[model samples]
Target: MDNNLEFKTIIKRSFLDNSKRQLIINSDYIQFEDKDLATDYFTKFLSSEIKDYRYGVRWIRGAKFTIGRDYQIFIRNNENKIIKINFKSFYGINKSLHFKNYSGILNSLLKFYFNKIASDFIEKFQNQLEFSICNVHFSDKNIMIETNSIIKKKQNTILWKDVRTKDYRTYFAIYSQENPANINQCYNYKDDWNTAILNTVIRTILKNKE
Candidate 1:
């Protein structure tokens, strides 16, 4: 990869043959363009202009076949302009075709979003005593999550010692390590953009604790 790497990709803008877009990503900037319209989708942005960002990845496999390879992302720049990229391609024979550019795009995208920010978020937890994103809340010693209690709506407070994660190819779930037979809750990667970051933050913190 050079200073800037470009890839031809599809932007999920309805079911059409020309859902094409061009992505140019570098260390400090990104440019997404509508190849069909010859106009900008996410015109361009510097690192400082990024206000909020989230991404999700899904690679499902079984036996000797691949089921799905999907990548989804959204970024909101300082101007409040947002750009979305859903690279699942179409269904059937073309479903996983978008994966051809998945690795390269995600590697660069992770560097763009995670570099230093991971440490920054960890630091925030250290300073403020908590961290929250995408409606998931974490504390210094436990994770507070929503539970399915039909009687009264409440959150399930799972201690760090009991918090166990399970990666189910297309989703992630947390369960009590003491009783792993029942999953507490699951977050589907395709639906939750920040699932990757949440996984990183939790894993990193767990490693430090260990």
Candidate 2:
């Protein structure tokens, strides 16, 4: 079977007195032929690994689980034809009074965290069945620069000093055919960031058709 997959990251930021940020990372859509096996494997995997990495899992009413409060995973059976699983993670930063260099730092942290999770998934399922990861993309960073504070109509409002938004788009295709060689090399990297980048690059290559 030909491989086609994609994942995306969406980032939103507010640059006001109360600076805030939110990030959403989504995995490539996956479909499993054996619903029972897929559910069991993922459930066990999350139960053992989620908490170890500062994430909590909540069993949401039947066959649905929530990860880290904002992230959610659930299974849906479509008339017994196929079973669909959706997984997503959300991270947010609240506004703080103290000035801190958080935008770049938090962005890197979020990327690292997302890559870690992806690596874990690959490690677990690479040998079991066919899977692909590709189309690496990040939404345009939305930033608002606070110009000045003013009282308007008896209300306080901050004027936008500057606003900018743009998308970061890249394409790469990876497939299970190049498994252990490509993936193992990435795992062998001593630096975490290097490992993440290599893994992502290899996956993108495999997903791409020459």
Best-matching candidate per TM-score = 1
List per-prediction Cα lDDT, in the order shown.
0.66, 0.27
Number of clashes found in candidate 1: 0
- Predicted candidate 2 versus true structure: per-residue lDDT over 49-163, tens digit per residue: 2211111122233235432222212222222222222222222233231112223322333343445656654453434333322212211221111122244222112111221
The lDDT leader among the candidates is 1
Query: What RMSD does each model have against the real structure?
Result: 5.2, 21.5
Model 1 worst lDDT run, 10 consecutive residues: 5-14
| Candidate 1's TM-score | 0.71
Local error of candidate 1 at residue 66 (angstroms): 12
Worst 10 residues of 2 by lDDT: 138-147
